[model samples]
Structures are given as structure tokens and as C-alpha cells.
Target: MTDQSTPLAPRQRISPVSRVAEIVTSSPVVLIASIILLVVVLTALFAPWLVPHDPVRLTPSVRLKPPSETYWLGTDAYGRDLFSRILMGGRVSLVVGVAAAIFAVFFGLILGLFAGYIRWIDAVLMRMVDGLMAIPSILLAIAIVSLWGATIWTVLIAITIPEVPRVVRLVRSLVLSAREEPYVEAAIAAGSSTALIMRRHLVPNTIAPLIIQGTYICASAILTEAILSFLGAGINPSTPSWGNIMAEGRIYFQINPGIVLWPGLVVSVAILSINLLGDAVRDALDPRMAKRGIER
Candidate 1:
């Protein structure tokens, strides 16, 4: 008679979003990475509206002017608006980075799947990957750019060529492991085609590593593009790039250190953020590690 209608115990409520909140709150590196990425994205999205002056248009009299009311980030030697150009240049930086990563990963996955799945292709793929591993990526990129002529396409292709083999090796290793799983074996026993098993079982399982690698490749691509531009082997001098900005700044470091400061700072922050993002992804994707991290 005490509480026939009501339960003896009080019901406990749990929120689904609590887990997401816990993750964001506990992971300082991830939170910082997210913020850094957010800053870049916001800057890119508002570049056209945010810049006070035309990036490409020049004012001869105002060339090399210091930071002031007229130009927040100061003028380059060309008298073009520094703030505008930096923001606009981000578009190119991001484009080259992302495009190169995609190109490399696409080719990598195809090669990796064939290499991992087909016995005949395995030796050839491994040998090619090994050959690529012997050469430093920067040197390879430099050689390719030298031959293709210094243009955006050439730079992108150069970046792609070096990254593909590394990605293929990583993916091939993953696929080889995945092929041994019960689901894969079941598919094989059920008479599923190799292509179907790969598509349905192997590729999906390899997604996590692939995603982490893609981000790393993107960061690397940016660095590569910057190096190429700095050395006068990348995008046309007429165009603005983070690297070109820094390259030009090196000459004026004595007169106006701000030339090197702004672009260099941007590059460092960008690369750091990308690394942080990679760490976050690696942590998140590994369940055992995530749980251990959360506990710690």
C-alpha cells in the first residue's frame, strides 16, 4: 500500500549529448584544434567582406606603409593591401593543400586495394612504394616542378606524386589486416567476388586510418607548396601565396620584420592546428585509447 502506483526507485535520466560534451570538455588538444580550424574557416568565409581594401589593386604612394588606420596589416612593397591579400591568399593555400591530398589519396586507395587484394600486384606495388620511400618528398616535388614548369598545376601534381606511395603503403597494410577478419572470411566463403568483399568489408574498415592520413597529407601539402613558392618553383610570382609573402618578406626583414611576421605566424598556426586535428582524429577513432584518455 506504500506506493503501488509508483516505482520503488527513482528513475535516472541520461542525456545523449552528454557524451559529446564530455569529449569536447576533456580533450584540450581537440578543443584547441577545433578553435584553430574555426578561425581559418571564418577568415576564409569572410575574406571578401572583411578586407578593408582591394588586395590586387595598388597605391604606389602607400607602398611599404606601416600598419595604420588605412591598412591594418600594413602595405607590401607593391603597395597592395596586406590584409586583403593574406585573406585572399588563404584560398589558394587551402585549395592546393586539399586538392593535392585528394589526388594522392584517390590514387593511393586504388593502388592499395589492388596491391592488398591481388597477389600478382602485391610485389610490384611494394617495390614501387619502396622506391618512392627512398626519395625525399621535397626533392621529388622539386624535380617534378623543375620539369613541368612552375605553375599551380605543376606544383599540385608534384605534391601528389610523392604522397601517393606513402598512402598506398598505409592503406595496403590496413587492407591486408582487414582481409583476415571474420566478416571478410565469411564473404569469401559465401562466394562474394573479391571486388565486392573489398568494397563492402575492407574499404569501410580502413576509413579511419585513411581519414587521419588525409589530414596529415593536407598539412604536408601546404608545407610543400610553401617551400616551392619560397624557392621560386611554385605559383606565379604575380599570384599571392603564404609562401610568396614570406619569401618576399625575407629581403625586407631588416627594414620591416612585419613582412615576415604575419605570414609566417599564419603558416605556423595553420600547421600546428592541422597536427592537432590529426591527433584528435587518431585519439577519437581508437576506442580503447579514447576510453583510456577519458579516464585519465
Candidate 2:
């Protein structure tokens, strides 16, 4: 007979959604950062409806006006609404950042799987990856933009290329470690196809790290896009990107400091929030971190 006095251990929660929620709410910094990121992303996504005026519409009459009831963030040298431009500029930055991250991660995952599982191709692929990593990302992006012209597509391509090598390195390392695991070895012994083994046994191991890396890549891509625009090698001047906005505002900074300060502030806040969220994700996904927390 079982001992009546002995109580059963509480069941551990295994739901993925609940786990994600617990991780998100465990830290106040993560919660706040997630909220801020959400707001910024939503605002950017609906910029067309939220903007009170045409971001690119020029008006010479009310140029350099300070923040007021008529202009929430004030008017630029061209008399365009600063608030409108900021909102619209966010769309461009977010799009480039997100798209670049997705593209980099997608391509990187494929290349990394092949290189990690197929030993014959590893050396050749890694050599190419190393060569790309040797160049400074910004300079490489600049060169690409210069060659292709400063369109949104070119800028996206430029940012994605520099970021791919980093993701490839990350995924490759994860796959290398995972491929040696018992499950992977068993799969190989069972005559599973190379793709099947990678997809079923190795890919799952890389998901958490890839998620954290993607957030960082998104932040970096945003900053790089801004820098490219500032240097006149990003999107078209007529387009209102955060970088272009600040670049235009620099010439008249003495007249209206808001022009540069506002966009710069937004960019800084967005990047900070993304980075903090990434950190939170990293902590949540790391078993060592959870063990330390439990010990504490």
C-alpha cells in the first residue's frame, strides 16, 4: 500500500505558451521593453493613418516652426511635419530591420545546416563565410548601395549580406554540436535522409539562439540603414527614413534642434528596447540561467 502521508510532487507546466508567458513576466525590464517595442512597431505599421500630414509634402511658409498645437513635433526646414515624417520614417526602418533579419536567418539556416552536416562542403563554405566576415559590415553595405543605387531594395540587400555570415556562424556552431547528439546519430543510423536528419534532429536545437540573434540583427540592420541614409547611400532623399530625416535636420540643427534630436531619440529607444528584449530571451532560454535562479 502507498504511504498516505507522502504527498505527490506538483506537476511541472509544459505548455509552450505558458512557458513564454512566464518568461516574459518574470522580469520587469523584459515586460517594459516588450511593451515599448510593441507600441513602436504598431505605430510604424499604421503610420499612414496615424500621421496628421503628408510626410514628404513641402511647405516653405511655416518652415522651422517649434512644437505646438498645429505641429506636434514642429515643422522642418521644408515646412514638412516633423511628427509625420518621424512616424513614416519608422516604417522604413522597421521594414528594413525585420526583412533583413528574416532573410539573413532563412539563408543562414540553410547554409549552416549543409555546412555542419556535410563535412565535405564545410571547409569550402566556411572559407567563404570567413571572407565575408573579414570586411566591415558598414563598408560592405556602403559599397553595395553605391553600386546598386540608394533604393530600399538595395539597402535591404546590403544590410542582409553583411548579417548573413554572422547568422551562418551561429547556426553552424549549434548544428555541429547537435549533430553529435544521440538522437542525431540514431537518425543517421536509421538511414534517414540528410535533410530529414537536419530538419528533425538538428534544427530544433538552434531555434532559441536564432530568435535572440534575430532580434540583435534587427537592431543592427536598423542602425546600419540609418547610417547609410545619413551618408547619402541609403534610400532616396525624397523618402523619409529616420536616417534621412536626421541628415536633413543636421544642416539646420541650430534653427530647430528637434529635427535631429527627436528622430535620434526614437532610434535610440527602439534599439535599446530590442536589445533588452533579446537579453531577456537569452536568459529565459538558457538552462544554466534557470538553474542559477533556482539556486538563488
Report RMSD (Å) for each prediction in the order shown: 4.3, 1.8
Reference-based lDDT, residue 246, model 1:
79
lDDT of 1 by residue, 22-83 (tens): 55557897788778877986887688898788888868898888999889888888888887
lDDT digits (tens) for residues 1-296 of candidate 2: 97779788985534434545677798797788889999999999899999999999989999999999989999999999999999999999999999999999999999998988888889899999999999999999999998988899999999999999998999989999998888888888899998788778888898989998999999999999999998888999899999999999999999899999999999999999999888877876776766665566
Q: What total of clashing residue pairs does each candidate reach? A: 0, 0
Instruction: Judge candidate 2 against the unseen true structure and give its global Cα lDDT, from 0 to 1.
Output: 0.91
Residue-level lDDT for 26 in candidate 2:
81
Local accuracy by lDDT, each model: 0.83, 0.91
Worst 10 residues of 1 by lDDT: 11-20
The parts of candidate 1 lying over 4 Å away from their true place are 1-22, 293-296
**Candidate number achieving the greatest lDDT relative to the actual structure:** 2
Clashing pairs in 2: none
